[model samples]
Target: MAGNWNNLQVPAGVRDLLPAEAAALRELEQELVAFFQSWGYQEVLTPTFEFVETFQAGSPAGDEGSLYKFIDREGRVLALRPEMTAPIARLVATSLRREALPLRLCYSARVFRYEEPQAGRLREFHQAGVELIGAGGVAADGEIIALAVETLLKAGLKDFRLGIGQVAVTKGVLQDLDLPREAVARIKVALAGKDLVGLERLVDEYSLTGLKRRQLELLATLHGGKEALEEARANFIQTGAAAALAGLEEVWQALTAYGLEKWLFIDLGILRDFDYYTGIVFEGYVPGLGVPVCGGGRYDGLVGQFGYPCPATGFALGLERVLMARGEGQGGGQGGYLVAGRDLAAVLRRARELRRPGVMVIIDGESQNRQEAAARAAARGLALVWVD
Candidate 1:
């Protein structure tokens, strides 16, 4: 009778990172950490699972049903982190209070989100992000944008653009309409998708004036280049949404002073899906990718939700997407010098001597010739280093 057994397979939306691919990812992450560290951004690691209440501080638990959750032995609900920002905010409020102003923290971790997996997207994904807490000025905003651009450049990404927008603009436009909270939420969802038809339908249902309808339509078109901002400015003046226009101008001027004007474009319609984000928001995109590889913006009120009430801004980059943008292929295999020979003792000794942290793997056999041994080593993804 056949032996009873179970198939060994990872869950859907998750896969093993093969040897060479794992190495490539490690290299990329190390490079990013080093780059961020050089800029005085100290790295921090938060727990993989946090108490459910921690994430639900600002939003209802029912709203985030996609999160993986369970009740601990203590009877407290817990969840695998779906995102890092909330946990980091809690940390700042509780542990890092005594720390100095303008605290810079960096992190690299896996975030879980229950979503349909696709190319460059996985349910379990790695994210590297930094947060600047207590800094609440355009200069700080500009600095964050500049750092993001520099980080992507260091990661071997070219032909990328930074789409910048202020949430205040979208919020302001909706506020001017005096819509109810429920209606505002629906409008936000439509705007986030860049769904012009949906937005127009909602506007019509609400009986918005011709000017209000035009303004809503214009938000979708407020993307591309400098001219877009100018057009938005003119449109806002006529519609009396001057405050939103001014916020955009502040961000634009700050970016220009930081010498990042060329890298950014105004996207008034850029609405963050998360309600936590307030003020300026930005996302980094490269050619050939439909989704943003990196995203963050001012969440000046996020910490406030955690009882800290500190203003802050941050961004997170998807490691897989960055690797794809750099054209780095998957992990190949074991990466070390391979030693093969009939004299097992000598080969073992040589391998031990060469093995420090990242050098040497021993394979012993006399049946295979030098060429055969080299072929075997290559197949195993090891570099052949012969022993005399």
Candidate 2:
């Protein structure tokens, strides 16, 4: 029976893109891939799904529940890729291990995660990003951040801020407090969320007074330009935070040299994934967007989990989120030409001749006359070509 046919719709957290939306998405993807390639990053493609362990190797604690898992006939657990970085890590450790020390790879692919969908959140989404493998220190970190800034600009996003941070500094300062692991975890949540009230409560609950309470509070409030780093240095100079702060300082200097610091700021609390990111992490935020449009950082230990140890830094731009920020429909109108005529041979020849890279040509099949063809072309937002 055809009963309940209307109920057969896509599941929650996923949506289909119409023609204009699809075209816009492709255009952005092409632009980003070309830009990434210009920076010496070669593109790579990984499987849509990988062994469950691959994602687990880099995902944050408690994030495993978001994976969409299934067992194959071989009884091996497999899941859709929740993110590109982890899959790329697996790719590098095995296939590209013998290639070179610093491998710059990029990807444009779909990622799946099981989660409640909301604004800027989706179960299935597309991400375009790059990873610099086998590189360590401030230069690699600087390159990633600079590329991120340039990417947002290239995507036509004029109003955005890239907040850079060092997770190690946060870890170091928290460690010095000598708090229990669970307590440290709770405090990080508050700090990451910028929940000042919750942070204060946690401080009170732990009886953290004097410099200890102040230092913890600093992580939540320390955000701005160079002065933020200065403040952090003053407060954390004697602890392990010193080294991380020094590294971050170098990265900041490098970005300033790139003349891109105008788009950047220092946010020590920007711990993208406390467990996955080792040092120098950043997230891009637009004024009205409630979620980060893009984010990434150095993971010096991620590749190691795949049996090949190497340093890596990268960032991913949410294709949907970036498109939303640009506020553009980006229809299929650009370079679109509709060749319409009653002469089938002429129409076919003209279409073939007009078709080329970056140009779309469609031959009229249903249009009986020039008027009809023109209407059809206008409807699709294409330039009309009438052949008598």
Candidate 3:
């Protein structure tokens, strides 16, 4: 043990998935891919890591600090992506600009973040999501939201809630408060963490009194159905929350048309990664999980930062959390080895003949007697022994 110096262990907060779990994940990913494709969402892929400056544009409260960063060979800082929306926006602006307007792109990618490992939190995780680019309306937003619900239902989840919010409602509150930049940043950090005490302290620290103080407190509780929207509209109309409110109402109407209203609720307190999300934001949650299995929303101006201007909205579902919610069921059941005794070519031919969609027929590695071959085949769950 002492002489073997090359450690084969992976870093903390990451793990190697065994065969069963890996196969299950692959199956789930394929289901999502097929679902997204069915909705006319074309697939796209981006780099696992990119230049550090890529994430620095109008950065969110904690995004910059949360990145796993390092210096490249050329002395440029590169970071494993902490999220996909920004990078997808960059992709739309750079490479795919000439394709068309109102692009529908989906991706299954591994994103990295330097967060402590816990139940639903991982340093490395896979995200399956879509970005609706060049689209600016409630219909697009509603379509994305509806697609998300359908995907989850297809994944076999029975119970969950979708909490939708308009970030503009909160932004309007911040705008009206007109707190200093530092103060606004503090409030964002608190809100992103859903920390009410922190919000109260920040309000007091900034000497935000009267309407501003009351509004911030109310924002924390502004989650639920139509009442929440009504309250938000009433409070934020004077503060320029009208557009966001209208957009939320429009999307609700569309979602209603899709008969998905029962699964959705409004939460004006819902502010996501702050740098990009310009409008409606939503998160999907299920029982027995402390974190949302899926979350995303609108980012109207993200692509513009990459030298092209377009409005976009999308969401990424956390695959690990999804599998957690779904649980480890029976392993993937398939045919096992087909041992070739005397006639290897004939065995191979038979194996090929036996192979079909979603089924496997593996040729035995070496020649064996019929008894030995059948024993080995039976050991591997293969009922029939075809040894010629």
Candidate 4:
């Protein structure tokens, strides 16, 4: 048992991305960084671990116990960042506070969360994201949305929808209901899960009737094209909901101007999953993948909680999910020369010349006949056999 334990295995929800996966991840990061740079976004790096209180100091409810918390030598709670946006907000607030307004920053980072391990979910994951701080309104919102679409499209994912929503729509309606925090929490959870059935049951249990009932029902189905928006406004748009819809319309128009309307969608069903999202909330979904490949939205008040307020919007693209969605490339090919020669110098020289950085190269001692060399190379899936 001790020996078996010594052999080792990775913990659940954490993984070792093998060579090919690592290569693909690196390629994705480079392509995304280039894209962000082209858009005038400068890359930034933040600490992997941050003071836990810094997160709690956020404007909204933090990720809660999801943080991977630990007691450091100082007996203070420190945690692996659960997400980048908060830390980036802290960065903008403390260090870059006096820099300027509307800072365009990008980052490639590893975020940790203690969660159940499943397809598309990990305790540790890679997120390539950008943060546009000190920017507000539809134009800024539109820019983030457009950049998100371009980033994913550039990453080679064509089959996906940008599910758009305004948190205020949901927030507005919930506030109108005057429901207790517990019921609202339940409804939000159900809505986040897209469990209309559960939402309806909660509705009945809560005895919600009239506009409130209709409002919940409306949210459940408020996803699709612009037509969904029209329907939302016409039938169930509450006083506050109408204002939220108008803001959404402005962003929709901006997305149209960016020539990205086809990818645009209405997901009014979206809940205030994060309290910081005072305006737009969006997520990217691809064919056959249940988890979102990328997601973010405007959190206009988060930085202020860091003691420096700014309007900001951005999204994080998950490499593993994106790779799964694209379902292509990053595969190793069998293109190499297996050099079998008696002359060590000659064999080494030939092998060095034939070896491309990413390609495989094998050289064997003279004792191994060409046939044996060929067999060895063949075992490794190397196709070409060169005998020196």
Q: How do the residues 1-388 of candidate 1 rate in per-residue lDDT, one tens digit apiece? A: 3563435657878888876678878877888988989988999999999988777643422267657789988898889888888899999988998898889999989988776688877889889989999998777787788899999989888789998887777677777778888887777778776788898899889998876777788777778666887787777675455765676677688778777777788887877646787788888889887778998888887788778898899888999899888787675344787887767788888888778865547665753667888888877777776776
Evaluation by TM-score, superior candidate among 1 and 2: 2
Off by over 4 Å in 2: 329-332
In model 4, state the lDDT of residue 95.
85
Best lDDT among the predictions, by candidate number: 2
Those runs of model 1 whose alpha carbons end farther than 4 Å from true positions after fitting are: 1-9, 57-62, 237-247, 332-336, 352-367, 378-383
Per-model TM-score on C-alpha atoms: 0.88, 0.95, 0.89, 0.89
Q: Which is better, 2 or 3, measured by TM-score?
A: 2
The lDDT per prediction is 0.80, 0.88, 0.82, 0.82
> Worst 10-residue stretch by lDDT in candidate 3?
328-337
**C-alpha positional error of residue 161 in candidate 3 after TM-score superposition, expressed in Å:** 1.0
lDDT of 3 by residue, 41-134 (tens): 9998889989987777625563577788999888999988887887888888788889888999999989888777889898898899999999
TM-score of 4: 0.89
Please state every model's RMSD to the true fold in angstroms: 3.1, 1.8, 2.8, 2.9
lDDT of 2 by residue, 1-388 (tens): 4788657788889998998889899999999999999999999999998899988865665368788999999999999998899889888999987997899999999998887899889999999999999999888888889999999999989999999988888778888889888998898888877889999999999999988887787788878888988999999775667888888888888888889878999988887753678888999999888889999998888899889998999999999999888875455457589999988899899889899998889988889998999999998788999887
Candidate 1 residue pairs in clash (backbone atoms < 3 Å)? 20-331, 20-332, 20-333, 21-330, 21-331, 21-332
lDDT of 4 by residue, 99-169 (tens): 97889999999988777788898889999999999988888888899999999999999978989988887
Best by TM-score: 2
Return the TM-score for candidate 1, rounded to 2 decimals. Answer: 0.88
